[model samples]
Target chain A: MSINLNRFNRVNRKKIFNRIERTHKTAIPQAPKRPPLLHPQLDISALTDIFLSKFSASSSTYQSIDCISLVPQLVLQYTELHNTNKTLVTNLQSLLTLDKSPLDWPDALTLSTPPATGEQALGLSYATTAIAETGSLVLCASKQNPTTVNFLTDHHIIILREQDIVPNIESMWKQLSLSAEHMPRAVNIITGPSRTADIEQTIQLGAHGPRSLHLLLLAGD
Target chain B: MVEHYKSNPQGSASNSTSGPHQTLFFKAQSSHALLDNTLQEALKKAKGGFIEKRSKAIADVENFESYKQQAQLVKNHTLDHLAYYLTQFEDNLIKNGGQVHWASTPEQLNNIILHICERRDAKSVIKGKSMISEEANLNAALEAAGIDVTETDLGEYIIQLAKEPPSHIIVPAIHKTRQQVEALFRNAHDLGDRELDTIAALVDEARLQLRQKFLNADIGITGANMLIADTGSAMLVTNEGNGDLTATLPKAHIVTASIEKVVPDLESASAILRVLARSATGQPITSYTSLLSGPRGIEDLDGPEEFHVILLDNQRSQMLGTPFEEMLKCIKCGACLNHCPIYSAVGGHAYGWVYPGPMGSVLTPLMTGLKQSSDLPNASTFCGRCEEVCPMGIPLPELLRQLRNKEHEEHLTPRKTRISLQSFMWTIQHPKIFYWLTQITRKVLTNTTLSQFFAKYIFTSWYNSKELPKNNSKGTFMEQYKKSSKQKKT
Candidate 1:
C-alpha cells in the first residue's frame, strides 16, 4: 500500500504553505548572510600541520610520506605490526602500478581489490579532500572506489594528497562543487576510527568500523 | 497503543509511557526518579562530562557565537521557505532514483514502513538510533508484525535489551549504570560465566554480536540528521559508525526524518554541522558523517539496491506559524538537557514521553495537549542556561512560559494556584492594602515567636531544606527609602 502523494500535497503541504504565507506576510524570507571563514588565510603547510594534529587528537594516527609509492610498504608494515593474517583490500590502482607491483611484494603480505565482503581486515582509499578544521577525510564513492572498502575493515588507511587539503568544511564544499556531478552518491567525512562513549560514557574504539585509521599524507601530490 | 513496550523488562524502574498525558504524572515520576539510586548515580556520572566537553569544544573554536548565529539564520530562512525546499529535496531525490514518502501522522509513518518491510518480506532488520522511530513506536509495530529488529548503536542496544525508552537523546541509555548493563547483558546473551567487567569488554561483546546482525539483515533503518535539498542527500552523523553500516550493508536502506530536517543546500547543512556536534557530544566531528544520496550507482561495487526516505509531519505542520515555531530550530543536541538542573536531578524518564528537559517542557505540552502536560512547563526554574548554551538560539524558557500561559488561559492550572495568583494580583493592585499587609508581615517576622509559628506551620515547605534569613530591625525597603530621601533633603 502506497501513500497517495497527491492527497498528501493537497492536505499537508497545502495547509503548511498556506499557514506560512499567512504568518510570514510581513517578513519575506531572504538569503542568509554567510559567516566569515574561521580559518581564511592558511598556507598548505599550516593546513597540513593542523590536520595532522587534529586527526591524531581524534584517536587516529598518521605519517607524512614524501612520496606516494611508500603507501604499500606502510600497509604491509601495519599488518605485520598487528600480527594479523587479514588481506589488504584497496581500490587505488596507482598503488599496484607504482614503483613495485603487488606481484613483487613480500610473500607475507596479501593484496586484494575492492568489493570487499566484510572479511578484509585492511582497506585503503584515496580521499577526495581533507578538512583541516575537523580533520575529516572526504571520500566520494565511485565505481573504482567502492564505499564498502571504507567501512568493512578493521584497519582503514587513507591516502591524503597534500594539495587536496582544504582549510575548513565550507571550503571543502566549494572544492566538491568544482567536480562534474552535483554530489557523489556517497561522500563520507570520516574522522578517527569508529568509537562510542555509550556504555557508562566510557569511549571505546572499533564500534562496527575500523579500529584504527592511519593516514598517509602524500607530499609528492 | 504500545503500553507493554514502554514498561519493559526493567518493569516499574522506568516509568516512561508511550501515549499522551503520560506527563500528567510528572510529580510522582520525578519524585520516584529522585529516589532511584541507580538513575541518580547514572545521571551524576553522565552529567559533568557532557557540560565540560561542550564548553571546551566551544572555547577551542574562534568566534563560536558567530557560527551559532549563522546556524540560527539558516534554520529560520529554511523554515520560512520550508515548502519550497522540501519540494526541491523531493524532486532531486526522485531524480537520483530514490523515492520520497510523506506521512502526516505517526500511525501513517509506521504503516508506510511496515508496508515497505512487508513488501520486501524482510524478516530481520538492523536499525541505527532514530528518535523519529521512537516517536512513532516503530519497534513495537515491527515486532507485532513478526520482524526481528535489532538496535545497533551501543547505547540503543543496551536500552533495547532492557526494553526501556532512552533517558537521554544523544546518549540514549544515560540512566543505565555499568552494573545494570552487566545484568541486562547477562540476562539477554548466553554468556557461560564470561567476565564482563570493563566498559571495553561490554563494547567488544556488543560489537561482536551486532556485526553479525549488520551482515545478515535484509533492511537497515536510520535517521537523518540533515537532508540536503540541493543534492538530494541525507546526512547522518554518528560516532559509532552503526548508521553507515546499517545504511550500506542491507539490500534496502530506509531513512526516517521529519520534514523540518531539510536544509537549502550542503553549505547550509555544513553551517549547522559546525555547531551540531560541539553542542551534542563536544566532538569536532563525529567519526562517520555519511551523505548517502540514493542507492548505489549502477557500476558501484557495494551499497543498497533501494533507497527510500520517509518524511513525517506529525503535528510539525501546525507548529509552522505558531509562537512555538522557533522551537523547530532545535537540532536535538541535548545541551539543554545536560545543563538543566531539573533534568540533571530527576533525569529524563520523569519528563515522560520521548523528549525531556527545557525543550521537552515546551514540546510535550505542545505536541501532546497542553492540558495533559501542563505540569511539564511549570517544572522548570527558568534557569535560562538552556537558551544560553543552545546552538540554534531557541528561547526555551520563554517558550515554556508561553505554554504556561496557554495552560492558565485554558483553566488547566490547579484551582489553588489560580486562586492564590488571583489574590496576589488583587492585593498588588490595591496599594494601600498591599502596604499595610507588608508592614504587618514585617512586624510579625520581627517577633521571634510569631516568626517561629509561621515557619513551623505556614512556610513549612520553604523551611524544609533552607533556613529563612534573619529579619532586619529596620522597616520595609519603602520606609527606608523615604527616610533616606528626607535626610538628603535636610
Candidate 2:
C-alpha cells in the first residue's frame, strides 16, 4: 500500500512540475536589488525610544521599569486602574528554560484556560524578542508559554528585555532561521492590541482580542 | 463556453458540477445599486477613509515603488517554480505533523472538507477570512451538512448573519452601514431587547457571542495571506486576532488556501508584507501576523491537535500559462476596490459576488468564464486607479482589455458594440480616408448642437444619462490645415 502511494505521488509530482515548466520563467532566488528600508544608526537605547514612540502611535502603551521588582508594582498599578480580577500568566515560571521568572510574583496570575472567555480581563506574557522597527513583540508558544494568554484576555501586558530588540523583521527572521530545527508551535509578530476597521471603515480597538497592549521594558546589563 | 465557468467569486454551494449563472446580471444589479439610498449612504461613510489612510501610509514610506517592484519580483519568481515550492511546503508540513490535501474543483474541495468534518463529527466550526473558502462556498457546504459554522471576523460575522456574501475582498461588510449592522445584530443575536445602535456595542456584542463560539468550536478554518514553503507556515494577518483564537482554541485547524499563495521563503514573505498592510489598511503591520505551521507539539500548552491544509487549484492551474496569470499575484488587499470610482459609487453588492471592484472585474470573468460575467469586464471605465494603487502591480486595465478582446472574439458582446468597434478599427487602419471622412462629419457636428435629431439617434441611451459638450465652430482639422496652407501662400 505504501509503495503504491509513493508511486502515485511520483506521477502526480511529475505532472505538476511539467505543468510548471510550460508556464514559468525558471529563475533562481536572487538577493533584493535594492533595500526597501533605510536603517538609521540608532544604539540600543535610542532604538528603544523610537520603538516606544511608534508603539504609542500605533495605540499601544509602554513604560520603562528600573528593575524587575518594578514589574509587580506595575501589575498592581494596572490591576487597580482597570479593576480586573485574575491575571493570566504564561511562561513566567518555567524552570526548564534558562529564562528567569519574576522572583516575588504574587498568586493573582493564573495560566490560560478555555473560555474564561471574557472572564480573564488581564494577561501577562514574556516576550521572546522585541522588534524595534515596527514596535512588535515576538511571542513563541511553548509548554510553559501557552499562546492563549496572548489572545484570550481583554487587556494584555508583555515583559521584554531591552537587549533582545531587533531593528527589522528581516533581521529577526534571519536569526530565527539559524535555530530552524527547534522552532516552537507558533510565532506571533504582534504590533498592537486587537483592532478592526471592518465596519463602515471605522476603527475599533479590542474587537475580539485585547483592547489595549501594555509593555514593560526591562533594562539589561 | 458560456456554461464552463459561472457564479460569483464567492462560490455558491449549489454550483457543484454546474456553476451558478447569476453574475450575468451585473447591469441590472449595478443599476439598482446606483439608486439604493442605504448603500449610497454606507458608501459615503466608507469612502475617502481607505484613500486617505493609503496616501498617508505611502507618504510615510521612503521608497514605496521599489518595495512594490521587489514584491512583484518575489511573486513572479515563486509562480515560475510553484510546483517545486508546493511540494516543499507539503513535505515540511507533513514533517511538522500537519496534513496536506489537494482539490482540483470546488466540488472536490467541498467533499474533502465534508469528509474531514464528518470523520471528526465536527459540530461547529470557526472560520477566519479565507477567500479560497469563499470561492469554494465552504460555509454553505458545512451548514448543509448540519454543522454550525461561525465567521469570527467582525465584518464576516455581520455579513454572515445578514445572509450576504462578501461584497469586498477585505471588508466583507463594506456595503453595510452601522444602522444596518445594529438591525442585523438585533435580529440575529439571541440577546434580544438589547440596545445595540453604536459600533462599539455591535463589536462588544460580537466579541461576547463569538468568544463563546470560539472556545466550543470543534474545527477552525482560515485563509492564508501567504504560505511559506521553506518553513511550512500558513501566515495570516488580521487586526482583530480572531484567527488566532480560531486556530489556537479549536481541536482541529483546517487551512483552505489557493495554491498560488505560496512564496519561497520568510524573507520573500516579509518583502511582500511591508507593502501589504501599508496598502490594505495603511498600518505598518496588523495587530497580528501569525505563522502557524502545524498541530500543537508536546511542548506547547494550547493549540490545535491536528493541522490540515487544503490547497485548492480550481482553475488556477490553467490560469498559470495564460495572460490571466497576473491575476494569481493578487494578495486580496482590496486596494483596487477601495480606489475604484465605480465601486465607490455602486458599492460591493452591485458586483454581485464574493469579490468586487477592479480585482473582481478581472478575476470574476477569469474564474467564472467570459460568457457568464461578460458585463463585469466591461463595467470598468478603465480609470487606471486600480492598477496605480495595486500592491502587486497587476495590469488591471490591460487585463480587462484582454477580457474585452476575448468577449469580442467570442461574439459575446452586443452587436452594436461589435459593429462600432469594427468600424473604428477599419477607420483607424486608413488614416487619410478617416481624416477626409471625419472632415465632413466634423463640419456637420460643428453646425449642429448636441440636442440635434441625428445626435439623439447617435448617442441613444448614452445621451439620456449624459449631455454631450457644445459644438466646436473651428471646423475639422483638415479644413484648418487647408486654410493654413492658403495663408502661407498669401
Candidate 3:
C-alpha cells in the first residue's frame, strides 16, 4: 500500500512539475507587492483608539487601564456583573508574577493557571500583538500560553499592552516574527467572541468558544 | 445518454461507485428545487443577508480593489510555481515536527487518512469543515471501516445528522430551515421535550453535545483556508472556534488541503486574508484566524500530540497550464455563490457535488467530468454577477462558456439541440438567408394567429414557461436600420 501510494505521489509530482516547467518562463515570476493597509502611519494613540473602536464594534468589550494591576479588579467586576462563577484562570506572566499582592483581589475570586478544561469559565492570556486594522489579538502558543486557554473557556479576558498595537495584519506578522524565536505551534489571531450564522442565517454569538471576550488594554508601554 | 446517469437518492451514502448524477440531471433537479416551497423559503431567507453583508464589508474597506488585485496576483503566482511552493511547504512542515502526505486522487487521499487513523488506533474522529473530505466522501469510508466520525462545525453537524451533502460551502446547512433543524435535533438527540426555541438555544445544544466529542476524539481533521509555506502553518479561519478546538484538543491533528492552498509566506496569506472574510461573511475578520503550525511543542502544555497535513491533488494539479488554471485561484469564499442568480434561485443542491454555484459549475465539470455534468455549465444565465463578486477575479462566466464549448465539441449536448444549433450556425454563416428567415419569423410572430401556431408547435419548450412579448415594432431591425440610413443619405 505504501509503495503504491509513493508511486501515485511521484507520478503526480512529476506530471505537475513537468507541466508547470514547460509553461512557466525560466525566470520565476515574483509575487506582486501588496499595497499598504489602512492608516499605515498612524500614531500609537490614534491606532489604539481605532483598535478599541473596532473591537467594540464586535461583540467584545474593552477597557483602557493604567497598568496590569487593574486586571483582577476588573475581572471581579465583570464576573459579578454577569453573575457567573468567581473562578478565573490565567497564563499571563505579569499577573502571575504580581502574585495577588498590591493588586487587591477579592477573597471570593479564585485564580490559577492550569490547562483549561471545560470547567474553566474565564481564561486570561496576553496578546503578543494587536492589529488596529481589524481589531484582532494575536496570541502565540507555548509552554506558558497554552492553546487551550484561548478556546476552552466560556469567557476569555486578554491583556493587550498599548505598545503591542500594530497598524495592520502585515505589521502584526512582522512584529510577531521579530519577537518570537521560532513560529509557535499555533498563532491564534482572535477578532471577537465565537459566533455562527448557520441556523437559518441567524447570527448567534458564543457558538462553541467564548460567549464574551474582555480586553484589558494597558495604556502605556 | 440521458439515462446513463440518473439521480440516485442513495448515491451520497457511498463513495466509490456513486456518481453525482444530479449534475447530469441538473435541469430536472433545478425544476424540482424551484417548486420546493420549504427550500425556497430557506434560500430566500439566506439570499439577501450574504449579499448585503458582503457589500457593507467591501464598502468599509478603502482600497478593496487593490487588495483583490494583490490577492489575485498572489494566487496566480503561486499556481505558476505550485510545485516549488508545495515542496517548500512540505519541507517546512516536516521541519516543524509535522508530517506531510501526498495523494494524487480522492481515493488515495481517503486511504492515506484511513492508514493514519489505523496507525493511531483512532476510534472517534472529529472533523472541521473540509470540502475536500466531502469531495472524497471520507466520512463514508471511515464509517465503512467502523470508525466513528463527527463533524464539529455547527452547519456540518446539522447536515451530518440529516445525512445530506452541504448545500452551501460557507454555511453547509443553508438550505435547511430552522424548523427542519429543530426536527432533526429532536430526532437525533434523546431529549425529553427540551426547548431549542431560539438560535442561541440550538447553538448551545450543539456545543453541549460536541464538547465531549472534542475532548474524547483521538484525531481531528480540518481544512486549511491557506497554507503558509515559509512558516509551515495552515491558516484556518472560523467564525466559531470549532476548528481551533478540533485542532487543539485531539491527540492527532490532520489538515486536509489542496495543493493550490499553498502561498509563499505569511504576508501573502495576510494579503488574501484582507479580502477573504469580507467577501465570505462580510466581516473584517473571523472571530478566530489561527495559523496552526504543528503539533504540541516539546515545551508546550497542551495541543495535539501529532500533526499531519494531507495535500490532495485530485485533478487540481492537472488544471495547471490550461485556461481553467485560473479556477484554482478560487479561495472558496462563496462570494460568487452569494451573488449568482442561478445559485440564489435554485440554491446549491441543484448544481450538485461538493462545490456549487458559479465556481462549482466551472469546477464540478472539471474535477468530475464535463460529460457527466454537462448541464451545469449551461445552468448560468450569463448575468455575470459571479464574476463581479469573485474576489480572486476568476472569470466564472468565461470558464463556464469554455465548458459549454467542450460539451458541444464532445457531442454531449442532446441530439435535437445539436441539430438545431448546427442548422442555426449554418444559417447565420449566410447573412442573406439569416436576414430573410429573421424577417419572415418576425412578421409571423407579429401576427397573433401565426405566432400562437408557431409557439404551440416549434417553440413549445420556450412558450411553456413564458409568454410571447407584445410586439410593436414596424419592421425587422435590419429593415429599420436600412430605412433610417437611406433617409439620412437622401
Which segments of model 3 are wrong by more than 4 Å? Answer: A1-45, A93-104, A178-181, B1-21, B430-436, B447-458, B479-490
Q: Which stretches of candidate 1 lie over 4 Å from their true place?
A: A1-45, A93-104, A178-182, B1-21, B439-475, B479-490
Q: Candidate 3, residues B70-167: lDDT per residue as tens digits?
A: 88878877886776777778878888888888776677778888888888888999999998898898898899889999999999999999998998
Lowest-lDDT window of 10 residues in candidate 2 chain B? B1-10
* lDDT for A71 (candidate 3): 77
User: Residues A26-143, candidate 1, lDDT per residue (tens digit)?
Assistant: 4444444433333334456688788888889899988888866577678889888777665878767555423245323456667788776678889988888999989899998887
Q: Each model's C-alpha lDDT? A: 0.82, 0.79, 0.84
> What DockQ does each candidate score versus the true complex, computed on alpha carbons?
0.50, 0.46, 0.54
Task: Let me know the TM-score candidate 3 reaches against the reference structure.
Answer: 0.92
lDDT of 1 at B159: 88
- lDDT by residue for model 2 over B286-330, one digit each (tens)? 899999888998767689999998877766776776777889999
Candidates 2 and 3 compared by TM-score, better number: 3
Return the top candidate by lDDT: 3
Error of 3 at B203 (Å): 1.3
Docking class of 3: medium
The C-alpha stretches of model 2 lying farther than 4 A from their native spots are A1-18, A24-45, A93-102, A106-118, A178-181, B1-21, B425-460, B480-489
